[model samples]
Target: MISRISALIAAVACAATLAVSPLVAHAQDQQASAASAAPAEQTAAPVAEAAAPAAAAATEKKDNPYSLGNIIAHGNTVDQAVLVILAIMSMGSWYILFIRLWDTAKLNKEAKEVRASFFKKASLQEGLKSLSETGAFRYIAQTGVDASEHHEGALTENIDHNTWVTMNIDRAVGEVNSRLQGGLGFLATVGSTSPFIGLFGTVWGILQALTQIGVAGQASIDKVAGPVGAALIMTAIGLAVAVPAVLGYNWLVNRNKAVMSQVRAFAADLHGVLMGNRKVAGR
Candidate 1:
């Protein structure tokens, strides 16, 4: 009975060891899997973080073309003088553009109405009266009519017909052209100067950046980007101001030229009409 009991107890202990061995093997396998997975997860975490910044940066880049905010972010690099010049150019250009546009439209409309009325009736007095109601074109129209009327009367004052006609036509054209060209000189000046002003600002900024780079003892993208970027803003802003002004200046100049041409033509036609009327009345 004692021998049987000893064998049975040994068998029970062997069974317990066998069961614990599988558990230890499973735990080792789990720990190894965890160790291997931890590096992948750690690597993946950094990749995800890196990708987030790239996506965000791409999104930001897509939103703005000029990215004025970026230029402003590095504001300290820009000179105050450059900023002031840019502001003045921008405001001045826009103001001239709007004012000149309005003037051109108004002049064209009034000239059209006057041309239609004058051609329809051929009454100089009626045309002048109709023109005066509009307030602006009356100056041009009245100058033409008054000069023609004066010359018509001067024909009786022993003045030569051709000389009197030529002199009054010259006076009328001069006055009309002068009024048409008013304030246009300033627009041209501003358009021509704005780009150079912006260039000066850019050069100033670059000089400042170089000076800083010399002091920093290292010339890297980080050190050079701010001042260079700020300098470029001035150049861009200058162009922004100059391009429209130049375009507007040219456009207004052409429009005024056209209107003035029409006025001169009208003056010539009026001179002929008046001369014909005087000769007809005399006959």
Candidate 2:
């Protein structure tokens, strides 16, 4: 586009030079004047070329009131660093959320399978056989049965069969709960701290904007409003980063509880079966 403008300007200069050539009264002076006009046109084109970017940039700002491009472009290193940090936090929060959701879904599916199949078996061995070897319920059932059978060992001399089995099953349940709870703390941290990080960005932005206002020696509303409002975007972005992390943390924690409830229910029933001496004898 600049090239086209330059070409058109050069053409206009040539035309004007041609039209004025007859009025010069001397050939050499006319030549000199034409040469001077050529340099002037060349200089003007460069000036216009330089100014195009500035005008376009201003237009862009006017086109978008809260211009992210302008913010990044004009923002100092600290401002940019804050933006980068918030972006990373947002991304990490989402990644953790996805991972936790997948883990929770797998647990829920296994629980549903347990509900459908594990309890319906005719005996402890049958139930344990029916469960998937990799599943949480299967692990608890196997651990219980193992404890029930290991009651004669020297380690079992002090602990009663019931207590030992309960301890083993409880331990298994706790481990399962731990697995369910793995990524929630990061989510909580993100939620609790992201807004403050964003607020820091907001504060930094306002400070810089105000500093700029001071440098220019003006307290006019437009100057103050534009930069201050743009600075406030940092706070808005921080909230955007923090909200999903918080909500996801609460939701995933609750879902973990639901999964754990199913685990506890199975553990309780397994405990009853173990306490009844279901596997103590040959059968």
Candidate 3:
């Protein structure tokens, strides 16, 4: 009878174990499913975040109102004309500045060559040969030589040899001075007028803004700011064009003065030699 009771208890315990096994397996399956789903959710989150910046960039591009496109598109005929004029002025000033600067540098280089090679020669004839054939110094020297050689005719009877040579040297120096001074006037004009031109644009823009305000019956920031700002851009552009021109003009002028001073000193010494007032080393 005890063995039959023990067998009955063992059978009841086995039945209870069999009933709980499926619940534990289901819980484990759910946990595994959740673990697999978490990785997919994390991967999808990064993709959504990456797309957000691209969307914002596109929106910002569409909403940008102060771009060059807007300035050109919304501007009227006069405003566009003013912009064109300022552009032209800026272009012209820069072109003149660069060209003049190149010329000045070349002249300065030539002056140095003249100083180093010209005075070392023993005689005027040898000195002439030492200078570059096409140089300004050579031209001045040749002119003096020719005047000295050719000053014995009826045409030159009134002027003495010394005066005749002096006159010719002066003329040659004047020619070089004119060449060095080229394009400077344009720079001055641009510098002096660009600001006023820009101010005109600003004034025109303000007038238009006032008209708009009168028509719309409102002085709101949106209405007032856009036109005023665009107009102010013209003034800024004008100033930008003007400042460089002024600075360049002054700089070129000073460089020209320095170059001319060297040339004049050379001329003076050359004159002394031509008139027999001073002697070269070999002579």
Candidate number with greatest lDDT:
3
Query: Once model 1 is optimally superposed onto the true structure by TM-score, how far is the C-alpha of residue 124 displaced, in angstroms?
Result: 2.4
lDDT of each: 0.73, 0.84, 0.85
Model 1 residue pairs with clashes: none
- Kindly give the stretch of ten consecutive residues in candidate 1 with the minimal lDDT sum: 61-70
State which candidate has the highest TM-score: 3
Candidate 1 has an lDDT of 0.73
In the range 1-283, model 2's lDDT, one tens digit per residue, is 9999999999999999998887765887878999999999999999999999999987783644456676788766877888899889899889989988887888888888888887787788888888888978888899988988877767677897678889999999999898878878888888999899888878876786688789889877766665676678888888999999999999998888888898899899889977776555636
lDDT of 1 by residue, 72-115 (tens): 54355445656676777678767767876776677678778767
Q: Is candidate 2 or candidate 3 better by lDDT?
A: 3
Tens digits of lDDT, candidate 3, 1-283: 9999999999999998999899999999999999999999999999989999988987784733544456788778887888898889889989988987887787788889888888788878999998878778888888877886678778787887778989999899999889878889989999999999999989988998898899899998777777788788888988999999999999999999998898888888888878773333227
Model 1, position 21, has a per-residue lDDT of 100
Would you list the rank order by lDDT, best first?
3, 2, 1
RMSD of each: 7.0, 14.8, 5.4
How well does candidate 1 match the true structure in TM-score terms?
Answer: 0.64
TM-score between model 3 and native = 0.76
Q: Which scores higher on lDDT, 1 or 2? A: 2
